[model samples]
Target chain A: MIRSLHIAAKDLKAEFRTKQMLNSMVIFSLLVIVIFSVSFGDLLGDSETVSQLAPGVLWIAFTFAGMLGLSRSFASELENGCLEGLKLCPVDRSAIYTGKAISNVVIMFLVELITIPLFAVMFNYNIQGLLGLVVVIVLGTIGFISVGTLLSALTVNTGTRELLLPILLLPIIIPVIIPAVLATGKILVNGDISDISGELRLLLVYDIIFFVIAQLVFEYAIGD
Target chain B: MSTNSQKINILSILTAIVMFIAAYMIFFYLPQMRDTSGQLLDSSFKIFYFHLPIAITSYLAFFVVFVASILYLKKGTHNWDVLARSAAEVGSIFALLVLVTGSIWAKATWGWYWVWEPRLTTSLALFLVYLAYLMMRQAIEEPEKRARLSAVFGIVGFASVPLSFLSIRMWRSAHPLMFGPSAQGSSGGLEGTSLQFTLIVNFIAFFLLFATILAYKVKNENLQEEINAKKQALP
Candidate 1:
């Protein structure tokens, strides 16, 4: 675990130095929100409908942005043979997977932090139960990144790296997306924890299941 | 080669015989279904026999892929990888048939070709996941690398099936539940022994059909591998 943390720290250090992926992810998510706001401008007048549509739109931005970040997570490693260096390190192979997943989750959270408020302002809506909403987003992001990171490593070596990631990742993540969207919608509307217990449970289960599976299979994915 | 051909011929002949029996039972041996008010239902309801069996067979195919994938990863054997690929291809085809037959049944019963129901959505997700699996295989050139990466994907992709299966039970689903306890009641289940027997016959038929096709696919993959070996040897 500590080794994984070290790897995570190294990735963060590199990511912070360049800020290229972070910047693009944040801007791309914001643009998704902007475009959504523009297309649904008329519906914004009706806060009722906008609240109904908000969760799906919000998740779309997060996932699309998350995809961008994930596809690049390993693509960066291709430079200077960094992935090979990481593989040669004195640690378990799963450590690399855990570290990459953690970094991907952090980057996704950062992007979500910027995107959420902009989304609220653009749609002129108030968010209730901020903490619950945060929990939902966090679990959802973890679930997405767990699978996304592994698939990113897998696809980075493929001929159509960018195009293949979403195709490969999206269908697998449907279970995550469904529960997260439902929980987000409930939290947005009522802010009631009791109401969304089911969605929360589903998201928690999905996060754990995929994370462990990804850890077990990460070796095969990145193995030479 | 003779033994392989003989085995395939026997399997195909058995599949043909069982399928004919199943078709006969479905069309002649069974009575038409009726509504709660004693009104005769549309003949389209017959598709349920085919639809249910195909869906179950496809699920069975994916299960094979899942097990074969884990074995391939564990043993690092070429045969397990071939089995996984063949099962996935067959599973993809069966999954597509589930969607197509399902849509036809839905249009006849619900007066719509499709709805975003949990069962339908999850089935589509299942199909797309395998489709992506196949596409990923095509994207890679190296046989060993392709096998390893796709084995990992095969395991990951199988995770969706259980979740999708549970979604119908977890949520308010419009899709009919034929067995076990269902939220919408057990009205959709088979009623008489004849109905149940026909369903059983169809199940057996489809399972045999799946086995036959899978065997053929596995043989084809092995042959392709041999050709590739020969080409490499020539160079």
Candidate 2:
């Protein structure tokens, strides 16, 4: 586990030095919000309808931006035989998976942090249940990244890595996406943590299930 | 080779006989359904026989895929990989049939070809997951690498089937719950003994058909592998 943390730190150090992926993810998510705002210009005036739509919009931005970041997660390792170097390390293959998942989740959270507030500002919506929303976001992002990291490694060696990743990832992640969207909507509209307990539990279960599955299968995914 | 062909011939014959019996029972043997008010239901109700069995059969195929994938990963053998690939291909076909038949049934009963109901959405998700599985196989050239990566995908993709099955119970679904306890109540079960019997017959028929197709597909794949091996040895 500590080795996993060390690997994550190494990835963060590299990522922070360049900030290329982080910049693109944040900017891309902001653009998604901008486009949504433009498209729903007429509906923006009504707080009721805007609130109804905000949860879906927020998750779309997150999913799309997260896809961008995940596709790059293993692609970066391809440079300078960094993947080979990582594999040669004494730690287990699952350690690499955990490390990559951690970095992906951290990057996704950073992107969401920037995107969510801007989304509120542009949509002219007031935030409620901020704590609940954070809980939902954290669980949802963890679920997404757990599966996304494993699939990223799987697709990286394919000829159509970028195209194949989303095709393969999206359908599999439907369980995660549904509950997260529902919970986000509940928190944003009703501000009742109690109302979204079911969704939160579902998200939590999905995170654990997929994370464990990914750990067990990560060896085959990255094996030579 | 002769025995193998004979076995396949016997399975195909059995499948054809059972399928004919099922079709006859579905259309002619069973009485037409009526609502509680004694109004005659539309003939589209018959599609349920095909739709439910096909859906279950598809689930069976994916379960095979899941098992074969794990075996392939554990043993690192080519046969398990071949079996997984064959099952996934057949499963995707059945999954697509489930969607198509379901849509037709929906249009006749619900006045819409589709809805955002949990069952329908999850079925679509299931189909797309396997479709992605097949596409991923095509994207890779190396046989071993393709097998390993797709084995992982097959295992992960099968997780959707249980979720699809449980979606109706998990959420308030518009889809009818024909058997077992549902979230709404213990309603929506077939009323007549004949209806239940015909459903059972159709289930057997479809399962046989799935097994037949899967057998043929696996044989074809093995033959293809052999040809490739021979060509490689030519030099």
Worst-scoring 10-residue span by lDDT in model 2 chain B: B181-190
**List of clashing residue pairs for candidate 2:** none
DockQ of each: 0.85, 0.85
Q: Give the runs in model 1 whose Cα sits over 4 Å from its true position.
A: B183-187
- CAPRI-style grade of the A/B interface in model 2: high
Can you tell me which runs of candidate 2 are displaced by over 4 Å? none
Residue-by-residue lDDT tens digits, candidate 2, B1-235: 9899899999999999999999999999999899888899899999999999999999999999999999999999899999999999999999999999999999998899999887899999999999999999999999999999999999988888888987788787779988777867745767889999999999999999999999999999999989999999996
Give interface RMSD (Å), model 1. 0.7
RMSD for each of the candidates: 1.3, 1.2
